[model samples]
Target chain A: MLKKGIKYTVALILLLIVGYNSVYIKKLSEVKAAAATGKFDATLYAQTFWQEKLTPGLAKANNLPELLTLLKSDKENAFKNYSHALGIGNLRYFLIKGIGKITASNENDISVTLLPDSVGQEVKLATEFVYGNAVRDALGILSINDFSNTMDMNNVSAEINKKIRTEIIPPFRAQAKKSDVVAFTGAIELNQVHLRLDEIEVIPVSLNLIQK
Target chain B: MSPKVFVKEEKAQVQPPTLKAPAFSGSYSRYLVKFQSLIALFILCLIISLLSDKFLTVANGWNVMRQISVNICISVGMTLVVLTAGIDLSVGSVLALCGAITAGLLKFGIELPSQDLFIGFTLLGVVLAGLLTGTLLGTFNGWTITRFKVPPFVATLAVLTIARGLTMLYTKGFPISGLGADFAYIGTGWLLGIPVPVWISGIIVGLAVFLTNKTRLGRYIYAIGGNESAARLSGINISKVKTTVYAIAGGLAAIGGIIVTSRLDSAQPNAGISYELDAIAAVVIGGTSLSGGRGSILGTVQGAIIIGVLNNGLVLLNVSPFWQQVVKGMVILLAVIIDKANSKSE
Candidate 1:
């Protein structure tokens, strides 16, 4: 009799789980349907992320000069404090703001010399092609788990990169001259082992020319 | 004393008549249990084929085979471990670590102290490195279990965490990518129009079958699982047999890791997360006794295929991934229940 009771309890629990799963599946299907029909808007999500999260979060970003100093002194601690990774095996992303003059300019990258002109520290602001998960993961605000699948998560990243290309990069490229003092906030990705401290490539979120 | 022995003999003779019916049923149920997984596989395939038009196609058949190849490799090793009444939770973590090591070796060749003796990343070197890493880790698990009297579960569980942590540290929590074409061929390349992984798994299954059926060590493994004290009394080196079994399991897991890494062309530190569960489920669903001394490699192969087909068919039918998890759990439970009923009859 006890065995029968235990079996019944297990069955009941399984049924409850199945029922709960069915509801989750229903909700997921609805989301999938929206995705299929192109109703789920990644561009809109990216826009909201830019205005509400990325721009607002810039104030909390690590200062470039300070971060470089920390990186030089202690690499691991600097990563722990400044960089963000969405999960294990993911590249670490950092949101950084700096006041720098464009020391070198090219079609691809604009080299910036951080203020007080430290000799070996150079930051390259990417003006041509913005790639990778830097902008999406840098602020550590957008989570992949929030999306339905990796494809959707990736779509958000693509949209964010597109936003950087269209709105952020064009104006900065048009008005800015070489050696112009500029204040910039951007996201940079780094592999832990290879620091590449000599040249830090950044995907700019916002860049403005400042009068010295 | 003679009179008492005679009386007992008479009683034993008398018991046969009463025991005859149950004896017949026991043998019948044993046979039923033996073929149970195979029957289930056939039925599952039928159901899936009926449900989806794409299921029975040659292309999809090959696709399913390729998909299950890695699981089959792991499950084959898992079958041996289960037969010895042991479990290796470290297989998944070992896979990740080995994959990372292999990818790292390929991407960044090791520098030897002697300037001229640098060991550049050759395909052979990377493969050996991955296999050696797995074997060493498995040996450690076996050694801990035997030498320290640590339970297999606890020992392997510890190794699981250690290996995964090591993998994270080695890769610095980033994926190692761009393994050259020679290494990629092991996973993605085809032989006679079948995937290379499928070929590798087939060879492993063949070798495992021979090892389990035709070797003295295999017999010892079964014996130890059947009754440890009896086997020990019978002059079996239980420690050696058990250790060897675990090492084989670890090596096979490394092969699975290599295949996964080659297929993706990248070794993610988080590769093979929770893979141990899938492998354990496959072993159980294959009709292997969790208590040990009973199971076959073919059953595990079938079980892995069943899972692969279920996954494929569900996607074809547009079933949600969440529902697939639910269904897989239900199937495993049902298989175990059936196994229990069969064993009870015996």
Candidate 2:
């Protein structure tokens, strides 16, 4: 009886030890996945984030008119309703995907103002609305808490932005002929309140020339 | 008396001592298996603790328990099946299928009139759907094995592919997320400073120990496994016991699935791919003979911890995941080889 008691105690202790190790492993893996800065594929990361987070969030979002009403009625509530953040609302992210034309460009920034295909009768889209890095900042899809430390996230975002600038712009800029139609899926921030009704700058994660 | 007997050795014609087999009631070497798994677990704990300071900490202690909860849930059921000398290869796939179904059902809610009461019922429905899917698929595996006279390996392997395919088809190979905070609570929430999955699995282990030790079905399972012909001669329902075991395995797999989905907050169709192997290894390591009729859930519990510790320790040491797989394979091989040697001696 004494021997059996000892054995059971040992087994119990063993299980407890094993269980503790399990916790350590889980926390370590979480830290590991979040801390990775430069080693993974950027396109894959961006694409997955776009598809998994941005697209779904956008699909569930209210339309422009409905959103405008919400904004007017309750700006805080509107932001609360529309916003999603990895860190319990640290930074907000939004998605805007539709057909539009590039009405203007900044040669230095390679940035473009998009005229959305559909225009409201009385309201025009904003001109001050910038899409690219500014949109990236507002969307806050790649926040540090769920992903990385602030520094690592900045570095990764910079790399992704660079990949977009060097690879995406040269081909896109060469084909920017008159009367060209471009379809874009991009991200935007809700805080850009002073934008023209017809003008919105979208950071094109994927941009295409519909016709030239 | 001993001196007199020694002096009488010549008179007794130098009688040799008879070798008595180590016994459990009447069985030979019965306690060997009980000790072997315990010793293995002890060795694992010793090695891990010595190598890493992180191994013996309190926070990690709960972490291991929480992480191994799903593994325990699955392996406990596996212990029964392996004792019957049958295997459930489709358990991982069943987990994926059940998890996907559970999440999908939550998303595929009925157009309820009210939000408050309806959410409660809908959640209940989701849990039932997950369990039912697991049970039904497990039943199919049992049916093929018993009725069609198909081998357990081939039948479960086929089911693995079929269920996995169905899981992917159901979700278009994408993970289903947004399962709600309430759904997540079952896995991630702590009732009393312990993770919920740990509580869930602990209850399952208690129930399993009771069922196998105290129930008629348990006796029939062992009897059938020990000697199928003798069990049949004694009028034991072999097919029924076998089917029930598989069914229980399936239901248990679903429990694992739901726990994983809740923990991850999503159900990827690809989730649980090859998880069955780990569960099987745990059973085998627990000193359960793969040859049937001889294993206990208690041993499997230790076996699972052994594996969990090894994986955990290796990672804490900064070992590569690739090397971890190799070590796991070796552990399984070493366990089976020892089992073979022990069986030979028996």
Candidate 3:
């Protein structure tokens, strides 16, 4: 009699698991179909991410001059408060803005000296080529788990970089001259081990000429 | 409690019959029990070699050994725990925590009480700290079980969550990476043309075999698992032996964590997720009865190799990852069924 009860109990548990999994499997199949056909568009997703999330959130960036001062004094506390990290790795991203005079301009990078406190410390704004996941990761709004695979996540980064290259950098490069005062907001990627306070290389999201 | 009263309580509770040498069966059955897992491993290799050309190469052989090394270390500890009819669900979490702590220490040295005074540990010190963390956690698990009479499963399960939460808190949800070359050498460095992890696991297996076969504590462990009431009547320190076994298991898990961290050059908060399942599978597939007292470290080593080969071969053959999980589960079930049948025949 006990044996019979155990058999029925086991059968019921199996049935419940199967019932729950059926719904899960249906949803999985729908995702599989989209993945199989390459129907999930990462470029469009990135385009929306930029306009909807990043542009409106630019004001949230830490002020470059003030951030540098804090970093010089207390590196650990500064990173604890201002930086963003995703998943389980050693990379930290910072979103920062500063008003500076263009110290030097070139095809590769535009070196700018901050107006008030950071006169000697030059921040390079990449105008010709932009790489890395700075813009995608700096906001900490997009998660790697939300994407189907790493390739999709990488494609988002590529699309974001392409947008900056085409839309943001070209306009700034066309009219801007040497010693021109400009306000720029961008993302910077730093390796925790080799965080250099000397030179900050930024991948610009927006650059506006304040004075010619 | 008196021995007579303890024996009465033990006798009242139903227990599975221990695997004893057959009185009627000849040497053939004895050999089968001894060599079944080995035979299974050999057949698995033969099949994989036939299916994938890459399986027979030296590079691939080393890769398989390297991949199995972490599992082998965890399984060695698991084999000891299972021998006492206990389970440790926290090995995976303990591994992650230990690895995170090790990396955290290596990257940022401990700050002293006095301002501007910091102390950095050498490689040996960092590794010892990792092992100590695992041992302490394991000892706690054992103490909780022995003192409170809590089931090993529940005790370890609680520890699993606690350790994982502690790991995330220490790492602050970020991975610690770029550990110097000196530290990376433990994971990636090759000695005498073999991966370091393989060498480390080999030494562990050898020492475990010696411990189980040659020591009095080993005998006590088996005695407790075979019949606790009988062991108590024999005046064996069951609690001490059980706790020691668990501590050993935790230390081995820490070793595994260190290897994994070194190999990846980063200690991720999510490292060793679901690793306990793999270690359990290795122990079970190696012909160790989950009820305890009748398994060997060599069997676990062979079982780990089989699993590693299957993982490597499936990836080589372009099998889907989902299907691989299904196949691995079936293999474990098949192994247990075969073990049951063999023991019944004996």
Q: Using TM-score as the measure, which candidate wins?
A: 2
Error of 2 at B92 (Å): 0.2
The digit string of per-residue lDDT tens for model 3 on B26-120 reads 57667877888788888888988999898899999999899999999999999999999899999999999999999988766565443444556
Collision count for each candidate, in order: 1, 20, 1
Q: Is the docking of candidate 3 incorrect, acceptable, medium or high quality?
A: incorrect
For candidate 1, what is the DockQ? 0.02
> What does the lDDT read for residue B248 in candidate 2?
95
Q: Write the per-residue lDDT of candidate 1 for residues B276-302, one digit (tens) a residue.
A: 888988898898888889888888888
TM-score value, chain A, candidate 1? 0.80
The model with the greater TM-score, 2 or 3, is: 2
Per-prediction fnat: 0.00, 0.00, 0.00
Comparing only chain B with the true structure, the TM-scores of all models are 0.90, 0.89, 0.91
Total clashes in model 1, counting residue pairs 3 or more apart in sequence or in different chains: 1
lDDT of 3 at B48: 85
DockQ of each: 0.02, 0.03, 0.02
The digit string of per-residue lDDT tens for model 2 on B228-263 reads 889999998788889999999999999999999999
- How far off is residue A42 in model 2, in Å? 19
Off by over 4 Å in 1: A1-212, B1-31, B112-118
Each prediction's whole-model lDDT (CA): 0.86, 0.74, 0.86
The docking category that best describes candidate 1 is: incorrect
